[model samples]
Target chain A: MPSRASEQVINLIEAGLRDGSLKAGSRIPGERTLCMECGVGRSSVREGLRVLEAFGIIRSSAGTGPDAGSFIASEPQEGFSRAMAMHLLVRSFNVADTIEFRELVEGWSAAQAAHCEDSAQRDAALAEAAALLDRMDDPKINQETFHDLDMQFHTLISALGGNAVVDTTLGALRSSVLGYVLAAVKQLPDWRAEVEILQKEHRLLLAAVHNRDSAEAQRIAVQHIRGFAERAKIGLQQ
Target chain B: MPSRASEQVINLIEAGLRDGSLKAGSRIPGERTLCMECGVGRSSVREGLRVLEAFGIIRSSAGTGPDAGSFIASEPQEGFSRAMAMHLLVRSFNVADTIEFRELVEGWSAAQAAHCEDSAQRDAALAEAAALLDRMDDPKINQETFHDLDMQFHTLISALGGNAVVDTTLGALRSSVLGYVLAAVKQLPDWRAEVEILQKEHRLLLAAVHNRDSAEAQRIAVQHIRGFAERAKIGLQQ
Candidate 1:
């Protein structure tokens, strides 16, 4: 259970946010001020602030200058990913469920991207994804770099789908399972062959989206995800 | 920025989790012990522990007893919902995007529930949902109770879909938008009539799932969500 003092501090900050008194980049009160306002000691205030920081809702600076003290912020994707990764580590969630959820969301996102009404935005995202594919084609690229680019490519496609919630959820899911994914890659006997197959699938997915073939894009997205999981044996149920 | 000491403590705990040294319900080291082990002060250790508690990974009990100190736990749903709610309050995500995402996920869940392979599990979930609907039919119940039941009904459907990730995501999304939803209810001039319409829709959705009508379940799920949002004016694009 959290200390009552810390809860008080958290409640105060949350109230400030709900009332629009604290906007992004708005510097919050110092520890002393928070303590006085919330009737709590400095340690409790600090603890509450740390909790908020862990949630990526605030940023703190070291100095007493203009850029000092804690400020309200919004970086929920990092916090979401971190929380998800921790849960996965503790076995609170399993890899199979995560992959299943990812496949569904990514499939929907791909279809939506293909059906995107804004041609300019859709084309821009496709170009960015193409560039990521081009980077992945470099033979000298390591597994980690290739994986990072791969995640970025998928995230870009989801962003083009015009749903921020889906994009964030997919990004966090990818990050949560990243360790297992990388380990699986390392275990593969033919890494080059696997990469070659993945590159081909990526090209097909991109082309489908570029041509506004919603059905094909969705089909490829689901197939590609399930194929990788099967090949790497990341989330297979016994 | 979190203090370096707190970060050190957090890293230590995460490492323990990753290495299988920590399991759910296992008691973690005390603050003094953590301070010594992590080379940090007691305050830093407490701050880090507080952060973990905020993430729903640990629970602390007061006093010196068998269950006194913090114990590892798995309650990511609470943490996810809290983080999402805070982000929503800060305008990091708008209601429109959330509703759109919920529609997609819930529709998928309803279809999956209808197509569930395990008849026993599917029937059990449908029975639970029917019970919730019965409770919602209480004419004297307040809007709050009805809304809570409504959310549980939807969450149960998602669970029946057999994806924990989707279940948690939908729960968090519903909670993130709960305040606005309740406020919209307060604004309705004919709350009773609205409740009647919602109850009818819920019955139809439950029947569709119970009958294994996947197409009808999916269609009703999407329509119900969009219809509620339209009627409540919760996420309208002004």
Candidate 2:
């Protein structure tokens, strides 16, 4: 918990946001104004802002003008992703448990994506995911590139599910384990060999989603995760 | 993103914990020492500690010897629960989306509980859950009592499921909506009538778990949540 003055400032700011007084993408009041309005010291206001920053609720910019201060972030997921990753690194949150939770949410996401009403826009998005999978076939690519593409593919699936909550949770969870995943990629002896097998699975999964086969979509999704997790032997090395 | 110095201090402290240098019951390095080691000001160390405090990772004591300063918390869930609740309050998190996510997690939890192998400890936990349903049948009980029992019932199911991830996530999500649920209780036109229906649902849910009926457990669990969300009309007023 923050100090009393800090808590007061946080509550006041969050309340404003909730009631539509503070719109996303708009700058929050400056430190001086907040200190005055909250009747708190500048330090207290700064502390409150720091908490928000850690939660990925707000972002600050440097160097003058209207866009230079903390703003209600229009997109806060990156903030969340970073904070959660830091926590995961600290081992305060377990990796294996997170993967298990991931299985359930992602299974649902796959099913939901399959069940999502057909629309050209959604179809285009699914095509994008499939294309990303195809792109992952390149053996010459580095682990970082492959991981980014994989992240994009998974994120797109959750987004297609049309569940904002699942998208956020899945994104956060995936981001949290990213360091381990990247490490696992390096540990993998033959990236090309494994890539072929994984691409085949991805094709099956994409086909299921495309065919609106919810059960197969979920089945393949869960199996793909469990299968890779087994082969990768994640969390085993250290 | 905490200030640079704050980040260094956070990293140093968490590294200590990861290496078994900072036990849960032990006081973390004091501000003076941390400032010296991390090359940061006292304010920076305190700021980092405050962020960790907000995350529910550590707690500080007022003035004293070994009993004082910040200690690695034995129970950090309360801190996570509050941080999440505050986030939920700000519409930075959505309730309807959260409930939808809840259905999937809790459904999986129910299925897991039903599939849990027979054991004296597990059986006793199941029995306790059943007893809770029975107690909820007490007509003289107040809304507060019923809600507490309801919370316990759900908590036990997730716990018995034996996934730390689900338990932590469920706990935080439940705590986040507590203010809404408590308020909804007051708004209900007929608490007794609704409580009766809810109790029956709980009984059926418990029986499914008791019978090791995984499919039924999952189905009933999902339905129970959907039913209550509809009745409480959560997020409806807003």
Candidate 3:
């Protein structure tokens, strides 16, 4: 067969999961059992498990009996950010494109969240944004902290939007694009001023959401992102 | 060490590529050399190579001489898509959500493409969309062909948008979401009516782009996607 034994193992396990023959969190067979069942060598079984574990598809533990075996994992989005972010960094995508991408999704998300009927969720999202803003004045605050809070702010907005796909995709993209953005921000000459403006813009975004003005919220959100992109051009030039 | 040896090897190779030590199409050292250099066994090297090969990050050909070793591959985006698509499928993301996600990005891409300064690129995009329309009526068209054309249309628009990050992110999302979308579409009644409407919408969208009407193009594109999402819902319900 053209397929490697390890790949065959991966396929069998995936098919089992899809067909409900293997349920999430259930332990898989031991190395010997898998070797016999899949008709692959022990090394192939182990390699397959290693690949699955790498993708967060399975968890492995050591001991004895059921606890010792590999189990299907429910880490749906664990490795998403790392993989995407690393790839994006290598590609060296420009700040304008990144910001534009972010704005398009964030604006849609804000529009959705603004019209969301759940007052508690809206209030919670606003509170999260407020918490991040409150940390803006920390004397020892570094670029990484700022970057993280920025992601949290965007993620909270996406979740409030109530579209799970948009929330997840935006969340992953935000995480992946953080490193490049941080690098760009740190190179800016007037970063403090820029951050202050961003903070104000964020407050405006939250206020627009509270007022249920989706248009205003969307408009401000896009502009804020565009402004960041424009500023990053200077850094790019340096 | 807490880390698996195979994963360490994967990282080592990735670092080399990112740092320019391993340029694209360069031949990687044989298994023995990697084993000695990385202080891992031959099996570990093999496992790492398997993972990379699966990723499309490298290619191996059968031979007995210097050409037998793994060589760095071009088009890393292909690997990105394969890995991402598999994961997204496993997560069972809703097709409706994926359609909505595509609408947001694709609409933006259309508008951006409308603004492309390069006449050649703009014409190429318009031509591709038109060509897909021409092929819409072939009786032998399967779901895969339909999905491929659908992706080609969106990818062309994204490329015309002139944003690598947006293009790549949208590309991955489009490919990753295709499996579920095809499954959902297969369940639809009056699939022909739906396809016809989609084709008409595609034409109108193309007209807007041809006329350089960014706003109208975006509107038509979003509506087109929303229509499919509704059809997909009906399909899922059945």
DockQ top scorer: 1
Q: How good is the docking of model 3, as DockQ? A: 0.35
Residue pairs that clash (backbone atoms under 3 angstroms), model 3: none
Stretches off by above 4 angstroms in model 1 are A118-123, B117-124
Using TM-score as the yardstick, the better of models 1 and 3 is 1
Model 3 over residues B181-213: C-alpha lDDT tens digits? 677788788777777888788788888878888
Instruction: Kindly report the docking quality category of candidate 1.
Output: medium
Which candidate would rank higher by DockQ, 1 or 2?
1
Tell me the tens digit of each residue's lDDT in model 2 across A24-99. 6768899999999999999999999998887767789988976699987666665555545545554556777777
Off by over 4 Å in 3: A1-3, A17-38, A92-96, A119-122, A234-238, B1-4, B10-42, B45-49, B52-72, B140-144, B234-238
* Tens-digit lDDT track of model 2 for B1-238: 7889899988887677655687566678888999999999989999999888877667888887667888776666666555555556556677788788888889999999899988998988988988888888887998888898898999998888887767877888887777778887787798888888888888888888888999999999999888888898986654
- True-structure RMSD, every candidate: 2.0, 3.1, 3.8
lDDT of 1 by residue, B136-200 (tens): 99999999999999999998887888777778778888888888889889988899999999899
Number of the candidate with higher TM-score, 1 or 2 = 1
DockQ of each: 0.63, 0.43, 0.35
Regions of candidate 2 where Cα sits further than 4 Å from its true position: A14-40, A61-71, A90-92, A235-238, B11-28, B36-38, B62-64, B71-74, B235-238
Name the 10 consecutive residues with the lowest summed lDDT in model 1 chain A: A74-83
C-alpha positional error of residue A67 in candidate 1 after TM-score superposition, expressed in Å: 2.7
User: How far does residue A231 in candidate 2 sit from its true spot (Å)?
Assistant: 0.9
**Weakest ten-residue segment in model 2 chain B by summed lDDT:** B81-90
